[model samples]
Target: MKIQILTHTYTLTIEVETQETILEIKRKVEYYLGVPISSQTLSVCDWELLDGLDLDDYPIVTEGTKIDLTINNHIPAIEIRRQIHITVKFSSRKHNIEVDKTETVGSLKEKIHIIDGTPIKQMTLWFLGVEMDEDFRKLSDYGVDEYSEIIVFLKTTSRMVAEPPSRKLRFVVQTSSALLDSTCIPLEMKDSSTVYELRELLLVRKLLPIDDYIFIHKQRIMRENCSLRWHGVENDDYLYIFKGTVSRG
Candidate 1:
């Protein structure tokens, strides 16, 4: 099957086999783009790919899946955190780590991704048997504290329940005056689609240039990992687009 490699400035199509390792694909990228394999990081839905793993290890990666490519430009990517200890249990294994209570669940997932090669999209965190469904909410908001035991479940087809039927949502993408000359693009998509997917669709269709973007709905910033329905977006709703990322406070 073919997959797309998305860089900050361009997208490349690469045919891949299910049995192929991520490191092998990185070598191909190195040959095609002249970027060293050591400098490239491939991810799908913010899940970092492990060099030792093959495509089959990641069920989310499929035909036409878009993988994000991030280049290490010798910049320090680590951030200082006010630490609190926590235990993340996944199946039969457990990992103890330090995290900031002020960070969001999404950030926590990223930290888990760094520790283990699990994809952020595949993880479902729980505390006190209640699922942490809101990625934008802080750990403290979920009542997570020092030495909290966070349960982790991997999302798989077998573990999934019957999904709700997808509904078509027609809406307008209103760009800022500095972007697209204040153009309003009409779009139709499924309610199940995420804001990040919508942004990828725009970039793939050349409706928007390759760059980081933020979407806002009804004055509230949209979460990339969340669906339109989760944001209370409806048909004919106007989604405002801006040319930057959100600053998590």
Candidate 2:
């Protein structure tokens, strides 16, 4: 089984047998991280794990279990700084960023833009499954701690047309497959069209199997349930259609 060990600044995945004891797991973590087992406090969710207990006997220690390991030692206030290392997940990509606790959400978004080239206006940050809408709030206000995982979603815009429009905005779709020829087929689509609707249109125009293809915008796979307006898909935006399974790294 795969166990994910999360620390203050890093996340480590380890494979262990079902019969392994909690102490054994601690030893393995110590060997891999160079931290003493005595100094580490391991827990599944919020419940602490006893070192003598066998992992198989624990109902919570199943496959893909996430174990949180915190150091029991205390640091001096004068030497310790109020900063944190967090993982920001954007689509299939994950970026580790070190930020000060006093920094606002808007400032963090700007920092992410500098690193990944994603526009600040289009970025939406979420922590612990809750959206961070108050841009002026400090990171500490949201209870953000070290090694927290923040999800980033990009919003795209659609082109504006004059009143009594005869057609929709044109988009250029390209295929990632090398075997197929790339075509600059101008697809006229409404800004209100859902991603699934666009996928159906691609099936007819690109002549590719519907199930085998996924639409990607700005390197992120567009969710089928959302419309172009939700994604901020603007006029002349490049959408890459890939054949096969999409990798979420």
Candidate 3:
């Protein structure tokens, strides 16, 4: 079967036996591409590839059941080694690591990629996860860890990324000194009590604009119609408040 193994900026394909398992296919591709198995991953949906189902359940690899694979192994090319400095943000902690001159962005991601099993390509990594911007490519685009603190987005979950991060952040005016203009609000509160309930005791004195908006979290973004009352808002989260009228259509 024809398969697409995609990395940050490259995609390669190879024909394989229909009996191959995901883990098995992963190893072969890693070997063929000179990438490390430690850094690569395979993605198959429960319905399409039946992610959790056994390989035997997949039947035989057919002609065009295309499975898109994102190969994350970034290996520094065969070249002289040089210490390149870079600032990497993992969770809430940011660290400066000096890597070889040949390191790829795929390599950098593994160091900070969540162990909970979320693939690097699926995660939206950022400078504080928001604020000023520039979309960052793996080491191929920019050299890192020079000397000073140069902020960058380690990963983008979006493709077609035709452009990098925009210099201006979309801002919405808020009535209080509390709610971030960047924070997202629920679309239609179940009731006035819903809004009051969502805002914590710390936000008791503050009054939200009572606008319909979506609550975007690290894991999920709740629509305005749903309850945002303690669905999970973290301090690390930087919300984007919608300025326009809410729409469900």
- Write candidate 2's Cα lDDT for 1-249 as tens digits: 667788765576665678878898886665444456777788987899888888877887887788898776674221233457899998889999877676678667756875788876687789988899787788889988889999998765652222222236678877543325775556778876777888888777655654545566654445576566445567999876644332222
Please list the C-alpha lDDT of all candidates, in the order they appear: 0.78, 0.69, 0.40
lDDT string, candidate 3, 1-249, tens digits: 455554443354544455656666665444344445555555545234433444556754455444555434364532212346566554555677655434444444444443233454444444322422222344434534455343434455444233222131222222212235334332322221232244432144353544433333332333332223222232234433322221211
Q: Which candidate is the best by TM-score?
A: 1
TM-score against native, each model:
0.38, 0.34, 0.25
Where does model 1 exceed 4 Å of error?
Answer: 1-161
Model 3: lDDT of residue 142: 54
lDDT of 1 by residue, 60-151 (tens): 99988989989886732222123578999999899998676766786677678768878777888999989998877889999999899999
Ranking by TM-score: 1, 2, 3
TM-score of 1: 0.38
Query: What number of clashing residue pairs does each candidate have, in the order they appear?
Result: 0, 5, 14
**Pairs with backbone N, CA or C atoms under 3 Å apart (clashes), candidate 1:** none
C-alpha RMSD for every candidate: 15.5, 15.8, 19.2
The global Cα lDDT (0 to 1) of model 1 is: 0.78
Ten contiguous residues minimizing lDDT sum, candidate 2: 158-167
Candidate 2 colliding pairs? 156-231, 156-232, 156-233, 157-232, 157-233
Error of 1 at 171 (Å): 0.5
| Candidate order (lDDT) | 1, 2, 3
Which candidate comes out best when scored by lDDT?
A: 1
